[model samples]
Target: MSEKTVIDLSRLRKPDYNGSVQELYFLEEHPEWMVCKTMPGGSVFDVGTIFSIPNSDICRTALRHKIYSLLETPEEWENIYGHICRKYARDKEFLAFLSEGPLEDFRLRGADTHHLGMIDRDTGEVYRKSFPPHPSQYVLVKKYKIIKPSRVSYNDNHLWDYSEYYGADKFVVPLENIVRIGLTSGSSIYRNYLNMNDAERKNYLKELGLREELVPWTLFAKPVVDFTTKYEPEDRSLKLQEALHVSGSSGKKLLDIIKMCILGAILVSEFFRKIGLFLWDLKWEIARDGDKLVFVDTIDTDSIRVTTKANYNNKDYFVNFNKQSMRDYYKIMHSQWFEATKSAKAAALKSGKSFLEHLRAGQAEGYYPGTPQVDRRFIDIQEDKFNTLIAYIYGQATLDSTIEKYNEIGLKEIGYYDANGVLEEYDKLNGMGEETVVRSQ
Candidate 1:
């Protein structure tokens, strides 16, 4: 449905000229496709997306993806082009790298894919900050001329030092605060979801450089760090060229977003620390709109580590607050739960039942085979922890507002893990009703 247009940057550079973007327009014919188009009301611009391609110049592919993400694209494909649609486009520096890296030597590593990312910038509405994966791609010739920019490699990323570990990608990130230490008494290895019977399973474990006595699963290792960041299309340095920009509204907004992000990062970091859990990884990113600060990203699931109290069980295992732990624990449950689920599935098959029917039947029949009193693990643990975290964040808003939401659900506390007295009835604010007044407890 929409027309396709391609502008070749094969010659954006010239030996005689220093070059100027002032004389060029990336989307002159398709101004709407530009990520930062001025809005109709004149108050804001549509901060949109870019397009991408696979097995080509990653920077260029990411650049195109950044553009396409913010605008419209063809909904259906008619051919098997081996193309994948990945959201969260790279930042401007990446495009420059593709445009002007040393043509003969520039290579993109698997880790290079995460230099920077952009999410949901097309609309000026409420945004949901997402974690990474999938990338838009653009195919380019193996041999091409290079037109370099003063800035290249979009991120001053923190590349992981797990060179001896598995996988080519090593968790490269920018603005990451990390403290690496050599393994003294123990070694840690990251896990991949290879089938239990996969041929490489033995090799994968062997690569951890393990000794005969070190039980691999008992090692106290940190969780995988999933990086998150706001996709700022244009850097502040370029915007400063427009005016005495440090005092400019946009510049101030950028500063505000960064400050708020840091505050949030520190807040959670301290909360977990107080619980005797040390978080080795906490990431934050922000996008700006005038004076407003948008908290763009915070790594969830893999973000926190609930370190088991050392020596409590004589097996110091560090529990990462994530889904995998729940799934694995569920799979290994005392065989009773597993058998019940199998029986329920068979009964459903004989009855010609759908998922909902099976679920209701299972629940009515007490298919999970639980005693009235029980010890919880896995899903039960993660659910309570996640719910408490959710409550704490929301509970930070106005006491009256938080109470309003709390009352609607008839929930005094979102869950047992809420430790801050978030919905306690005896609190001064919760005690006051039907009248707005300033009072002391």
Candidate 2:
């Protein structure tokens, strides 16, 4: 079990002065230590004898001792304690206002808890400045007002609940469960995880076969962007082919690559249909866990750029746009495509041209043929299936509308709605694959 640590700022002592003083004096004198230690990268800053507190019981006890040793005067103690009391009083008032007003109306959905820090028992509120792993570092805090009475009351009442401030204390894991903690953010928590001692880290890696090297959690790490910006697509594609050749997987071929590309595009289309926003680009980080190729990293607004309309909108809206549902959709669709195309040599025999031709004929202008010829018939079938799935998820005729527009050019029965308010499956005609089935009036 990992050791636990506690840095009690309230018990700190003042420097130089010698008498019974309150803990607040020591904190006020070393406010920088209290505030800055929690800031991003602030842990590296050591003042005199104080090392930034580590998450361990021994370290916490030592820190507490050092703080007590610093405090020595009653006058200094009273001043600091008085100031702290006033600050707490102000915070309490704000908490009351929060409960009575906007907080009451605040609708929280899909809420997940993160451990900021411990709560002050007397004040009944967690100090925001001290909660983050690094208190001195600042990130932009998104602030908005609410107006629900119940939400306000809940917020106010919940302030007293320390459990609400500090989420589940223990990291509960079953004996045989494979728990992999991927570091995908540059947050302090990630840093702490990365800074674990060699032995501790080795134990963690043993469970998941994850390498110890630290990968930067930046959007720039995306393979697509890296390939497009640093090297020519043809050069990168050639490199990828070379890598595949060296791996000697007989099943992995140019056709498989093309299929993956098509599947990715289809997934993107579906994502746009549901979110009502078009993803400009996406970078997929795939890893094989046993027989499954799972996607890692977040797939949201931060990772990808999205536009509501074909053009940009100037209006500001509070929606996250980066919903988890969209991520799940991408994962599911990608997995399905991977399975479907595993043995698809026929699609590759046509040199990607067949798929392009079919896709072009089925859709009018503006839709680019993603791959060279393969099989237009299979391409049309995939497109229809993709459209149907999108309609089902989004409850909109995104596929139907596009198909209707393209029907004048030749594409027919792209998608249709069912009486159950779901996208209906297409009918297969002449074994050419299914076309969209529209609902009967």
TM-score to true structure, per model = 0.24, 0.20
Tell me how candidate 2 scores on lDDT.
0.26
Best by TM-score: 1
Best-performing candidate as measured by lDDT: 1
Residues 67-117, model 2: lDDT tens digits: 222122233334333443454464665334223321122122111112122
Please give the distance, in angstroms, between residue 254's alpha carbon in candidate 2 and its true position after superposition. 8.3
Local distance difference test scores for all models: 0.28, 0.26
Give the per-residue lDDT digits (tens) of candidate 1, residues 247-339: 223444333333333333333444444434434334343322322323322234332233322221122223334322332332333346545
lDDT score, residue 267, model 1? Answer: 37
RMSD of 2: 27.8
Model 1 spans > 4 angstroms off: 1-124, 127-206, 209-213, 216-275, 278-298, 302-305, 310-320, 332-381, 391-441
